[model samples]
Target: MNNRSQISHGDKSRNTRLGRLRDLVPVTSAIVGIDLADAKQMVVVCDHDSRVLARKTFRVRAWDLGAALDWAGQKAATAGFAGVTVACEPTGHRWRILGQLAAERDMAFVCVQPLISAWARRGEDLTTDKTDEKDAVIIARLTAQLRCYVPEVVDETWGRLRHLGARRERLVVELTAQVQQMRDLLECVWPAALTAANYPFRSTTWAATMTVILDRDGGDFTRTKRLGLDRLENLVRKEVIRWGAEKPGLRITRNLFAALDDRAGVIAHRRGALERVEFLLADWLETRRRRLEVEQRMVAVLDGLELTELVTSIPGLSAIGAATILAETGDPHRFSSARALVKHAGLAPRERSSGTFVGRTKVTGQGRPGLRLAAWRGIWGTLRVNPVHAARYTHLTTRGHNRLKPTQAQAAVAAALLRQLHAVIVTGRSWDPDVATFGSRRRPVEVAA
Candidate 1:
């Protein structure tokens, strides 16, 4: 007749799936599931056998956090349990506050993946309807069955690297968008501008020429023709000199004139278009500057870590890339093995097959995306410079019977890179090219010089 008693299942076979996790949640322990929210949290207490004991909602405050823990602990004690495991789905960053509160009391705080909790909800209720109360109980049940893991606690240094890495990723995405917009504008107004020399946006010459075009008669390609080749060359040289860069040569100036001569004739909204271009250029430059500043900070933080030297010892991994990856993977030594680290990075390959049908295998991609991205970016440089990685990539793609696609081979290499990174960091040894590859004993294949 009680709300807590109505939620029990009579299945005894589920115990077989617990396997080794039975030790983590003993019969004397209680599981406290917390559904974290921005303003309030839903807490549910359950015994080791998954019978709910008490459920309550607490406001989002430090005092309320302590009260929730105390209430769960009192319920746990009344239910004849000696220990408590605080569990949550880690919805956003709100769970950290509760987890921290639980940690201060020596309570075991664990996380159930959101995907796992969702599946458990569907399996439990036969309906998709959800509420914080239901989710809280589901989390407790999952914890009772030991379907959760304790998250790594990082120090202040790793915390700084993690946040900075996230900031840098956002800035890069914004800078990329702005650059694309600028390209579109150039295509509309000055089609020949891009064909001049493929000058990068960061180059001094490109910025100088763009400034000249924007200042001369409101960015009109036609007006630039009246300035003539000599005068235009002088203006660009002066602008370049003002930026402390070497002056553009006569040949470069001539190419600019030729490019402008082929520009599209006076189009409507030319003035508005130039104004938009000027705004975009200014905005893009500012974003680029901020991104560089973040990168510098990332490098500075990376310099203080002991793992930096070990990770960057690998030919292709840059200091910044190593910092990003390490930020996501707190201390690599905590991982049990290289395979464990690879799985943590979500680079572990997952195969799908049932009965007679077999499907293509791909990575699970269930791990930290930032860590995966850092490894992927590092692999690009590794393939270019590290002969061992290049050889492995080639073998994976060019193998006789099981040739992997380019992208698949890249994933494979990325996984291997993660494993190798864990290896060097844990073992405290430098990367050895001769022993790096999987099958190094075979005859050496000649790589182009």
Candidate 2:
């Protein structure tokens, strides 16, 4: 045993208590705690009294974890221990593989919070020095004290949906940045073009018009003077005619001609700076198109899952949004209550009260940020469209006590929506907008009469 794991000469009283604890605990139970990492893990096995029986560091591989468990169990068995529970700090997805192995081997497994593990490691000892071996032993002792919970694993479809949703979000951001870049380039080259049409980078109707400008045979728009204005105009006219004659979506192409024809002459000479603007602009459009395809796939996947109809029945919640909620939240069965679900998304109101001073309630914002953002989007959409949630928003604003600010109002509505969704999830009932009941009920505050 390491000196750290031993009761020191100064701690004789604690040593007596440890002996009592060791006697009280059944000889059958053992705890195997692991300090998880991306590349390797430090493991410690301890029987009832926080006494380290075995400690080892091994590369993070399935076989290594399996062999470590077997070796630890044998070590415990020699010490008259039978039952074993494996645990580790929740270190992102690093623990998943170990958890899965434990599950497969029929061993109990749990995850302790990193904060709790850290505090446990330094409690009273003020042990400034730290190592994987020490942390692993600490985790084992804490786990034996029942200081951990099981981590929930999401379903395969939900996992895919989450990745797709994340990708779509990134693509949307990229598209927005690209559009802004295109607008800036056009503003420099042709100020009148964007002035004619506020959102030219929308890439539906204006795409055809942009194609005409880009299809010029000469290197850049500066060559338009060399090609003569008539030839350039003729090229644009022919492209517009082709769009009208050949393309399926050209019905909207007609609107682009006037903007292009009017603004074409604004940039008399080309900077040659934005030669690939049209191509890059079209690439952004293509990214948006891919995002739509992903949304469609998400809808298809969500349609097959339970509680999806329940989720989508809420006003302003689309099937995609519903899928995002389910995916980001994992299985709702893991949450003990609707409030737990709300807290999981960090939507629960946090209290900030000190002596003689009280701070306004604010959402904790401590959980899954993506889930909170998804709920926020739903709240925004609901405020715009859903009468039930809108009324709830109105109620929140009109509350006699500390009426909510606009931002607070949004957070309140989002929390309410999250709770409603949670209720629908747990109760396995579809959201009924026509028979709105969840967020629609609030009694007026009684005032001095």
lDDT of each candidate versus the true structure: 0.79, 0.70
Worst 10 residues of 1 by lDDT: 8-17
Model 2, runs deviating above 4 Å: 1-28, 60-63, 119-130, 184-191, 201-203, 215-219, 222-272, 306-308, 354-357, 398-401, 433-449
RMSD in angstroms between candidate 1 and the native structure over all alpha carbons: 7.7
Tens digit per residue, CA lDDT, model 2, 143-165: 66756665777678767877878
Whole-structure CA lDDT of model 2: 0.70
Q: Can you give the lDDT of residue 102 in candidate 1?
A: 88
Clashes of 2: 0
- Highest lDDT, which number? 1
